[model samples]
Target chain A: MSEQGPAFDLSYVANLARLELSEEDVAMFEPQLQGILSYMEKLDAIDVSGIEPTAHANPVLNVTRPDEVCPSLPVEEALRNAPKSANDQFVVPKVVE
Target chain B: MSLASQTIKGLQTLLEKKEIQPKEIIDSVAEAAAVRDGAIGGYLGLDQELAHRDAEEISGGVLAGIPIGIKDLLNVKGQPCGCASKILSNYIAPYDATSIAKLRASGGIPFGRANMDEFAMGSSNENSSIKPVHNPWDLERIPGGSSGGSAAIVAADEAIAALGSDTGGSIRQPAAFCGCVGLKPTYGRVSRFGLTAFASSLDQIGPLTKTVEDAAILLGAISGGDKNDSTCLDESVPDYVADLQGDIKGMKLGMPKEFFGEGIDPAIRASVEEAAKQFESLGAEIVEVSLPHTEQAVAVYYIIATAEASANLARFDGVRYGYRAPDAENLGEQYAKSRAQGFGNEVKLRILLGTYVLSSGYYDAYYLRAQKLRTLIRQDFTSAFETVDAIIGPVSPIAPFKIGENASDPLAMYLADIYTISANLAGICGLSLPCGYMTPSDGQRELPIGLQILGAPFDEGKVLKLGHNFEQSTEWHQRRPSLG
Candidate 1:
């Protein structure tokens, strides 16, 4: 970690985000991201010790729907945009290997 | 005037009178768009045959035979809702978004696919993976984005009116840049059921139109409670068009000192202040109000919006829909490769920023603090509302800049959003209409300037009324760009 910058590793964060970035992306984005993070650091100066964080603008309660079944997308329509599908199921690489 | 250039109300009246058939209007618009949009690049595609057929069937609906442009972000059933990104280029919407359903029921023909910033991420349309949208007023300048194409198409008269999603000023800023009327309804005022999510908490879909009346009419058509979008308020939708009349007598308009201060371009500040004076003449009182937390809006927005964006966008993985990277060694590699290859630079940067802020170690320091600041920002508006009915300011700090000017500097682009992001953060409604034009230092040509009118949550009627009154007295909305 640098003395004046964030301690978080860029590559580590990118990996967690499931982003595959090249070395050039790393070199270019490191300082840029660092600058933005430092800019956001200004938030620390204002005293927010007592204020509760607002997760959303409106007050929302648990939204529930009736349990009765309704018409859903037909199998063909649901599978229309799938990159790889067979037998109306999305095909994926074997995870158990 | 050409059928394409007419406002929604004008076209609707014409269609109802049977003076012009819907097919003729679509054909005229299609021809004009083909010739002009080649330079403006406002549309991704146009389906005139379907539009013609749909138009012919409609008789006496509210928008009868009037064609409307759908932002590529909104799903119109059986159309390509690309969102102007390569990732979703081939993705066809299997069903209509609830907003589209309402529009169709009102006799609106969703005709053209307008371009946008990739996944609605950037302030300039330059971020579009397909092509950059040019401002109709000056082709050399950018149409402010992520609703760039929507605003540009409306200004150029390629679409009678268009729907745009505003998350951090995507709709209004672009409308301001392109010299049109753009409204962002309160967060829950309009259903977000069909619109692609950017910052789910802040995103709301609204209309970009040539006139305030057109905007009001379009807003009324699409807004109501929806069973699909739970966040959509169940409150009754007001008759915005009917509310457009009447004087602004005894109404107090607040001018936020922070928005009119040092960073604003002198010309834009003058134009907006002049519009305020016009409101004063119309029996409205102008009062100076302070939103002390205004300075913190952009920072708070970047954090919260991007955090929500990261979560909302995670659904675009390779398996179920959209693009999937070929030649991936494993599932993990596939997810990473597909996203990295599919998304544009701005989208990736935002996603990274979001992931970083929401990361374990930094959550309390960045995201949490930002949320706390968000509370303060909302309080500032809530407190100010007690003193004034609405707030007005410059829509953007500066006039439209040359395309590719700020594309390289992300921070500069983010700072431009300072004036417009607060309403979204506060969950209030805001409108931007052409107030005046400013000729640049080069003296080449004048660019349109927007005056932003803001109201409390669900106060869209007030905002539109004020805009309607101002627009009635000004020639700004009447001036059309001389597109070459």
Candidate 2:
């Protein structure tokens, strides 16, 4: 393992994932996250200079569906599970002042 | 024999012959679950009225009247789909997943909510926010997970068969631990429309059944083209049940040397090797092959899967359906507070690791490199398949451990998935069936060992045939666990 590995800023990473972690959570996860990152460093030794990266296992390209109209989930059914819904729309906290 | 103890095929025969009623079977299983599920913890919810209603209308179909367990990770329209996590604790699926719709159309009643590791994130069921599913073979040990409850219920006869999603051995490992047959189809073989995503690329829905034939039946029914999930292939799905009787004569089976090396339980290795010898006696050639990139599978899987997970789970903010923390100042606080409160430790850890790997500064070095390595892993299988019709190995390196044995140690828990992770990475199909059981020298309860058969993409017919032949030659699948 090299000292050049990312410092693994736990709080910064949590915020990136949209997770709010208490200090206790950060303390607990920091070392474990570092261990996993160092373990992942094993991939650097393999010379994959010319190998193509596979995003999906199947060879699917430009899968376009026809523009024909199809029945979709009804708005009421879709919003039925929303924690806060009114007027057939999901109500979210106001972002702007 | 107890009707509840019968396999899906066994019960189907009786149902078709009018010797036993679907209602009777459901009642017995529901009753048994009511009496025995405390020790097993298999079902998160069981709807008796719905089970009865589904049983009342059994007809002439492949899976008629067979009660199948639905893993909580799958959406069973109008049922709670918690994924065994607190985040979605109050969530109710408004529609059936493609597989569930198919199962219902086939007259296979989706009976109950089977438990799983939260968001299908853990190797053991312990990470479940609901409850830990116990191994039917030994209550103190884990039913290997995140498909733990699906395996446990089938093993305990609480359900004739069950549906489970495998992402890094969730289906196979638990099935092996619980002494049943489990299969993860080739990537895109089954539609993943309603399955909550843990890792979209690696996650696949599969069947956990009491017998290979039942697994074949369920797999065949639930698989095919679906417009909803673009990953599902448009290729024709073969009748897996009808194709299960083929002989393996002259077929080449590869035994990867990496699968048998150090860290594997000696007994488990010997058992899997013996299974290979059994294949030899069945006139199949067993060749020793090398998958050099095997060791890096777990490392690459964690990085890629978690990276995808971090992205996928971003949808579960407090705004839409699911659990939302109250008394938040605004949307941002709501998002963080809800996620932090809702997720379990394993989920949180993976999210953190995933976010780190995909974070702007580290994305190319970690995520891209892992994806490249993933290509190498897939090539290993593609090349190996060129020489052999199928590959054989142990499902897990060791038998099921005690409930909390690896709970505190994430790496050890991650290592439990080493043998099963490669197939997912390769986008190939694999099956796990009981090859043998090993009783420890210290006189602990005997544990089931699985023989994993791997086939090329869309080679489920070959895999199921091999499993059927192997099962016919041994008594391992016929053995039942006597649960308290």
Per-model DockQ: 0.82, 0.84
| Clashing residue pairs found in predicted model 1 | none
User: What tens digits encode model 1's per-residue C-alpha lDDT throughout B185-274?
Assistant: 998988898788999999999999999999999999999988899999888988999999898999999999999887899999888889
Q: Score residue B134 of candidate 1 by CA lDDT.
A: 91
Candidate 1 lDDT (Cα, whole model)? 0.90
lDDT of each: 0.90, 0.90
Per-residue lDDT over A1-97 for candidate 2, one digit per residue giving the tens place of the 0 to 100 score? 4765557678788888889998888788887787778777878879989999988888787777888998888999999889999999888888899
Q: Model 2, which residues run further than 4 Å from truth?
A: A1-5, B57-59, B441-443
Weakest 10 consecutive residues of candidate 1 chain B by summed lDDT:
B56-65
lDDT of 2 at B393: 97
Distance from true position, residue B254, model 2, in Å?
0.4
